[model samples]
Target: MSSDLQGDGGPDRPHAQTEGPAPGAAPTPPARRRRNSYRSLTSRLLSADAWVDTALWRAGRTIGEGMRSYDRFLRRFEVRGFSRAAAELGSDGATFGLLGLLVLLTFAQPAFEATRNADWMTTEDFAVTFLDRFGKEVGRRGIVLNDTVPLEEIPDVLVKATLATEDRRFFEHFGIDIFGTSRAMVENLRARTVVQGGSSLTQQLAKNLFLSNERTLERKVKEAFLALWLEANLSKRQILKLYLDRAYMGGGVFGVTAASEFYFRKNVRELSLAESAMLAGLYKAPTKYAPHINLPAARARANEVLTNMVQSGFMTEGQVIGARRNPAIAVDRSQDQAPDFFLDWAFDEVKKLSRRNPALARDRIVTVRTTLDPALQRQAEQSVDSVLTEFGQARRTREAALVAMVPDGSVRAMVGGRDYGKSQFNRAVDALRQPGSSFKPFVYITAFLNGYSLASVVPDAPVSIGNWSPRNYSRGYAGPITLKEALTRSINTVPVRLSIAVGRPAIIATAYKMGITHELQNTVSLPLGASDVSVIDMTASYAAFANGGLKATPYAILEVRNSAGQILYDRSRNEPEPERILPADKVGELNDILINAVENGTGRRAMVDGVAVAGKTGTTSAYRDAWFVGYTGNFVSAVWFGNDDFSPTDRVTGGTLPALAWQKLMAYAHAGIELTPMPGVDPARLKPAQVARTGDGTPAATQPRILSTRTAEVLGRIGRSLDALGQTASAGEGVAQP
Candidate 1:
């Protein structure tokens, strides 16, 4: 075996016999010598199996000793020595266990700072009741906050219904119900959706009382801790009472007492079982299950609540069968007919006007006497509905808004939308739409302010400002038309020419002075109504002309009074006097032009018989918005029609649906009421026997003719201004028309 090992020619052994190199021959190549050396080294390594075995065995022994030492250390310190150490530290086993619990609590007590805010408890202390011009209840908002009922006053069935649907194990559990939580988790996992919540009543109350509705682990921890504190501090009855009082029931009310009154028109103690179940259903999602909004869905939710009562053993199926069969019916408080839009606007007005009196502002419950005339409001709503029902599908129009107020700015009627329940957005007050030709009156007034009159003539040929060429509605222009005829025809080029002559800033300043609050963009299309303006603002601006150029800022609330009949705010006492914005002569000229338009031009559909009307029609690009804003001696109303998504309609112009609706509403509004002649208008001109004529014994809106010498001088200056404008456009300094 030793010879076999030695003869292997490994690197560790020498060769016994070897041949020498030939004389004068080349030595071995480096590559071939390296191969031989590698083979020898590899063979030597292959023969040393015992070395690898010894190294691994030594390593295993060292690892075993280290592991045994670790185990012994754990046994001594963790098991036996810890007990002795605790005793030395003057702590028994119970004391140490308490310390461990305290450490756990320290980690869980991070949300303790949330308890400092106690203001939420009094959030429902204010309420509002709305009335029309006459003292009849139209609607209620907020709550009768100071009228919180005690627990004993609440009907037993209502309490049981709330507990059954909200928390089945309310009395048995601590703050957090572990069994309920586990059950919820298992059920949610089974269904793959969150059908039920795990929070107890105390947890919900804790959130409503002191926390916001944020879904985070930290918030959940805070909720759990706060719930525990509530349970420890208050009795079960007190917690239940507080939850019932503070929980938000639907329709701008808080607490069951207010909800019962708002929905059933009765007290909490008078709620029947069916009504109780209905109110209980609102606790989950008040808006979703509000009976005033969707009665069928509310009944379905109430049926579910009844089922919950049965499953929770609070009542038998037979006991709940009556409620399930005869579901509750909320009081029919004219949900469809009530002036919700006007009420919403008037409520805001009340809050704003009340700020003048600190005592009035601090009052918890107040009655708002609004300026809304129910008769006119009904007519306005009907007019909008009739138009929509007739032409909505044909025109592809889905929404419309109308605002009607007196010349003095007392809002008489408003129809915000088709239905206030489905959408609370007050379109008349909130929606900003591009007024098409309806905006031309502002331009005409500006022209009058800039020394151009109704008789002043301008060429209506095709015009261009930079790359933007504003085309007329017909995509054609008439040549050399008087300003009266230009406005009467709602032509596009004349306004653009007039805008360039007078400048855009002057026009914007005139519009602002006339009560337009929205900012106007300084674009070439400003005369064409490219900027957005709200319906109310536009109507109020027109009222300036009807009011003999007086500022007619729209207002709704006439008076605000507390529950005790004490007047908190009276508009006549609190509001400032109207300021004159337009000169009487200028107002007369603009009013004459608008009246001519209604009589013989685009707004002919808006004219009411025996009443002098002045208005303008507006239609935007692609037929997106349509408007007809008109005013008589008594009232001013603005009507708009469009799709809510800003989609184009099927060629619905301002003279079509909008004008027709305005005519219907205004006709009805003027039927019984005494008609007041519009300022700057001659009632005699409205007579069929008479015709308005200029100083030359010629009709005001006769055929277009050559410009007079004085007008020629004005046109000459306008031509020079146009040349400068063209130069600016050529220099690439003009803004593109929208």
Candidate 2:
């Protein structure tokens, strides 16, 4: 380095460096000078900070001025438009005011309050009629009611599922949710339709409680106001309870309890998760989502609700999936059988009871436990159906009715027509057609009461009363026939002679005593069923024989109960000491004869397997009506066949059609019951004429005869006419009138 320096003449150049500082030589400076230079540079940078702050301040001021100017311009424009809008709005203000007044007045009615309370009377409940619980009558319909339940009694699954399905934010939101409403509005606007509803449960309750189903802005506004008011005034539980109680489910169900019973045939508290989901889904569209209408669609909607429940944290995923796999539940529709007629009959009686005691006519649900055995009614219907069907096939007879009752006046079953749905007219209680030869039983009963015995011989030849000549159904008379044969064969002339001897008035009185309330003509032909009477009256009259001469007024309802489970009335026992109209011995004689009529008389076709049936057959003039009234030891039944329009039909007799119906009915009625033998008449009390001829050498007069005087006379006349034509009377006897 020293040699390089020597070569570069560094030592010698020291003097030159010192002289003027060589071209590349460094200059030496004082420390204070360096510090001063650094301070000056810092000062310049610090000064530049002021300019930056000033420029920013001026820019912000300019932006502020521009914003003020824009705001002033907007205010001026808005003021002008608002003033014109105010003028236009002022013109329509009075119209809106009047509309508001009208709306307020309309909604202010007391009926609105009553509707909100769900208070309205039904026509049948308010009617004035003394109807037997079993008797068919007018202005009667079944009961429908609104059932309320406690909040806790409502299933938790239903609540959670309903919220999940209908409105998930029900718990957190007020009566109206702005966010949900906004979303609904935007969705509606985008679709250009009203496909979604944003109503809360409160709003729904408001609509159901106080408004008709009218869609309008004013109605919506009122609904909203009411909903808000409800939200503030009532707790969430109360609102939900009201909704559940008052909401209308389809199929005549008006509340959750009723809906639960209607759909599941179970209590609301018994609903499972899947059932709860289905009921929840019904809230959106009850008719559409009803399980009865569309089970698959209802299940799909229910599954969606279950999924929503899981998503909304109301139910777990596992629970929801389990609910989805559950089977669909439904009520047993069979239980809702032909209750309309029974309920109609029951309500009519309830009205009468209520009329007797107006205090019982309160606005409460009443349960009427009736004497009607559904099974018996069904049997009666089937029996009539089978008879009518068979008769229609065999004899072209398409009309018939049947009434069955206990001898104690309890109506067991009734069939008013071939099809109750097609025609609800109850012919059993209303039709008053002639009873024909069935009336002869009452005549004979009168004769027996007047001391005529079963063996008493009566003239069966042609008989004349003034201008009227009575002939036997069989033209040729079996002269001097026993009274038993006269009734058994339903002979016309013999009954005429018996009626003449006993007096028609006595026959009429006997009919009245046996529960024949209808008026009977005091004519010679009345004993031959010339009087018109209802099937019910005739059946009841016949029942007196079965009940040992005690007359029971036909009644239907056994008891009536209110919604609160109070027994308003009950008919568990007989009303009082029954009205006794005939002596025991007389009734016994008639019953024996009637039983003989079924065993070997015109009503022989009415016999059933292992059953002892007593009955009489009747065929009206011109074959307008056919009737059979009968009874077992435990039950009595009546059947009638006729045209409703009162037109003539082919010669159809009670023995042919009505007796068959009675047989079919008794066959079913006594299906499992043991057959008990009817108590026969006491021989010790029998008179000489009342003794029947046995195979042993007894008197021929004592033998039972099946032909009446009129029928025997008519048969003899035909036989005589045929004899003139070279045909014997014996060959024509079998060709007597039915």
Candidate 3:
């Protein structure tokens, strides 16, 4: 266009192109030039220098004009476009749209999954109900409610009980409890949590049926909206019924009706006051108040529920006491006799599985079938209670633990403490106590495994190893005794010498290989029960002896499955062969010696009337702990008696209480079952008659022949020696235990 605009006309530009049009000069007319002459045009066109100069001048002018336009556009027009767009997008309306987008995403996921609920709860992961090994419903995973009760079908007491506990102002509030939620907001702000939900029944139904259970402000806000939607659509009775049908109870149980049938093994129509109170209390923390896991806590929760019921004018105080008069139906020996202890262990395993999988069918419910014998569990509890009540009165000790397992090492029964109501600590699995002479079997087993003869005699003399000197419980040593006799009599000096001869490391290996997992001190006293171990370990180790010397791992869970019937875990599937720790021949020999201990030595109190018994007694220093670990061909069990505080008792030797407790448990456990002899030890080789029990309750030896005069003289001399040593040396106190 203009020459000044196209070219650098300022003073700073001295080398402007001379090829361009001259400033302020008119160009030649093309028509007149073309008409001048073909000859002149041809000559001018034919000159290559003239053509190149004309093209260069036009290209320079075109580029200069384009640069000026781009420079003007970048700073003036495009910058303003971006600023205007940002202002519009950052406005409140735009923010609202973004929030709406997030809400759609959050709700859309749950809504999409819900539309496909044509399948049963079984189709959900880990949502199917689990049954016991017998195929009876034990518990459920997920929201599996088989019996969907109507509002009319629900008991009045149950409705009031639930309303009193979960949401007292349910009928009063619209959807959300305004006052309650406001209070929860203030408290949560202080604690920084979704701690106190303070949700109404409708709100709970909304969250349970259609929510991710994610604890975030976005989820909470969505939950509030859904609750309001539920309130607007459904009646109050419909919402309450839905909540009752969808609530998650402990033991993977769901719904009021299913929980009624699961815990009480009865229909909702037949529920007792006590059962109703219990079901209502399960809302807050189902696992914590599960009657089987912790009866006392469950009872306490039920008591609170009953109190709520009374305060709400639903029931009287008299009715509350009467309802609680009978223990819940689950643990009633006359009714269910549930394996509460084993259930606790199995539930713990399910929890471990839940941790590995974040989305475990909401509330982490998974069907787990366990190996538990209800009959043996009952017998064990009775035996422990009877013994503690009778014998423990003097010791003033309130703690005891026991575990019983089959020859295959599947745990059948476990009692963590004397009374589960008083404590929840599982001593059988968790508590570590000195095993005392109960551990001697491992030392002798080490020797036996290494080719030491059971009949070989070891010198029983005063022993002083390093700075440690150990005296016989009763004065005067046996001088020389066979290994069988040494073990049968439980002599301290004998096992100490045997353990040292075999080497402590070998003993430790045998202990570990036999299933003793507790850390063992590498000192000389390792053989004398100086190391502490749980009753479960002792019982599991003894299973090797019962099952013909195979190393067995104690397990309670036998099968785990998801809702789709997929085998998530199976103990017997693709099972590996167990390790053979001791030869069957060696096991029989050990059995023979242990049987003799029960029949003739300190374990006499453990002898049963018709069955052959094999066991060992243990008493730690200062009577801090006592133990009896033993086994039949079919079962192995360990019992411990002591105070939780680790205080000395009234010298409650293992032989005195633990052995007696073992006898009581085995007597009932063996009833109606065919007795079998130990492997490799024929029953035909024993005496003609079974051992007898005197009126004083002391077991009579099977060997009927009277004591020989020579034996009597030897015992008489030993008595004199003991007398000379002073009464501090008790006559009946075994060498190892006392």
Candidate 4:
């Protein structure tokens, strides 16, 4: 190529060296020509280096000129121009930050959806105040205070203690404290467990208001977003107020005011520093630190709160020293051992009644006048405790339940277990146990409904149905015994025979109509009390006989009124009247038989002096359960003794501890109460040792054995027919229920 075309024609350029051939010359040997071409290329590259330097110098001059022009242009405004540019840049950055924040909020739609509940806008859905039948305040349930205490009204020490222990940086952050969270995370990582929570007070309020106690990532995300939403909407004061007002304090209490009143028996405004510290300590776990349950633990927790206040610079050690020296002591409630079990049941009833009435539900606060009798409740609790304390170890039983009600089905007292603190299982209302011979009344009532009188004869012999045979408790048959006598002895085979004779369905129908709510299975041993039933249900069923053959449905709440004195539910005004379930004569006959059972037979231990008692005893197979359900003219009560695991005791018959407990409870219940005659019961029969006499001036042996010879023959034929029918039934039915 020519130098002129290559633009390599400079006068100061060095001459190109040639090894063999020159430009445009004929090619020499191929290798010699190639070497010559490489040398020429090297000569041109060395020449281009100088040209490249000149070009770079020219470009540098051009850039210098442009920079000088820019400097001259900038010199017009001087320093002010730089400041304005920086301000504009900062403004742009702020706009981008706002947009980024909006984008982050967009990801919180799920949290917004989770926390949105219209009901939460208000303080509470409902608060319940419980009163006894006499309109005296025995105890309280639900949110006790209808109105939340203002933050200004709360003690300064309480607020300080709460902030110190719960969230020290409560006022320093917006919903989520990043610094606090990071510190907590590091600490948790070092410890390998979550010993400290990083949630702010606002976050805690959000969780309390809208979330459940769940430790899940999804729940945490929702809690965070809701906390942010709360911070955005509410001031710090409002958030703190809500946190204090909605947090759960123990003893079925919510909010500082209720907790103060519950533990110290005073208004929140009157709380001392020590009491305030105790209440503040319950924020982490209310049940764990409830003063009424465990005073020492509560005091220890309060001491921690006081120390936290000192460390947080809210108080000096001297200021908290008094609380440490003598911790707050709760009022002695020894006289008022509140029947918590009955109250719980009554609270549930209030909820149900409120749900049924939309207006009541909207009221959100009510005073329930329940059928509970405080004195009777105390007596019941004492009776159960005494029995379990005296005989529980010897009998190998750990639990006992007692339920007592008026003849009108008003539940006066209920003792769920020996100790309410150890367990909360309400055996009186929730547990179902086999009724044993106590269920025989339904079978005998069926016989009466079918035109068979108590004087009718029935052979109490060993009875067989398929592979199953029911024998008497003594394992010996009492041949040709009157129905009344059979029931008095609690003969199992006779009731089974009666059940088969009267049809098992009829017996079940009778039980249901009489107030047994449990679904009874139609089995061969059904009349022998194979079905499991609650003590409350059995008591209510027996109340029917006391209520003159009318179905006495069990009821706890007598009246419910709102805070504004408007009646929401009145049982007498709202509930339908009970219908007559059994004829008067049949009820009378059945009552006569049960009277004899309690007065002269197995249930004699349940007898109370100067009161007409009628009831039956029930002992389940292997002594797994023992029950005595008895009633005086004015009250009906049922007592049960058993183990929670369904383990058999050391042969505790119903006539033993259960009957004695029933007697104690009845004696207390019948005191100071006018005795009313039980429906179809002779008032004289209630007196001790006052029984009908037979010929020769002796007590009647088995109700005079009143069945005629012809009646006996008819009954014998009927018994045979029942045996055949029971065998057929057993083939179709399954084995008996335990």
Per-residue lDDT for 139-207 in model 3, tens only? 344443434456787788888889988888898888989987788789999998766657777777777
- Which portions of model 1 show Cα errors greater than 4 Å? 1-125, 150-255, 283-294, 309-319, 332-336, 688-738
Candidate 3: list runs displaced more than 4 Å.
1-133, 137-336, 349-366, 564-570, 686-738
Give the distance in Å from residue 260's predicted Cα in candidate 2 to where it truly belongs: 14
User: How close to the true structure is residue 692 of candidate 1, measured as C-alpha lDDT?
Assistant: 29
Write one digit per residue (lDDT tens) for candidate 2, span 619-738.
Answer: 888888888889877688889988888766677888887877777666655644433334454433222222222112232121122232235335644754665565444457666643
Instruction: Identify the leading candidate in terms of TM-score.
Output: 1
Candidate 1 local lDDT, 532-644, one digit each (tens): 99999998999998889999989877667787767777776777899988899999888888998999998888877667889999999999999999998888999999988
Task: Name the weakest run of 10 consecutive residues (lDDT summed) in model 1.
Answer: 700-709
Backbone steric clashes in candidate 3, count: 0
Candidate that scores best on lDDT: 1
**Can you write out model 4's per-residue Cα lDDT over 472-537, one digit (the tens) per residue?**
878788899999999999988888888778799988988988888889988888998999999999
How many residue pairs clash (N, CA or C atoms closer than 3 angstroms) in each of the candidate models, in the order given?
3, 38, 0, 1
**What TM-score would candidate 4 get against the native?**
0.65
Deviation in Å, model 3, residue 351 alpha carbon = 5.6
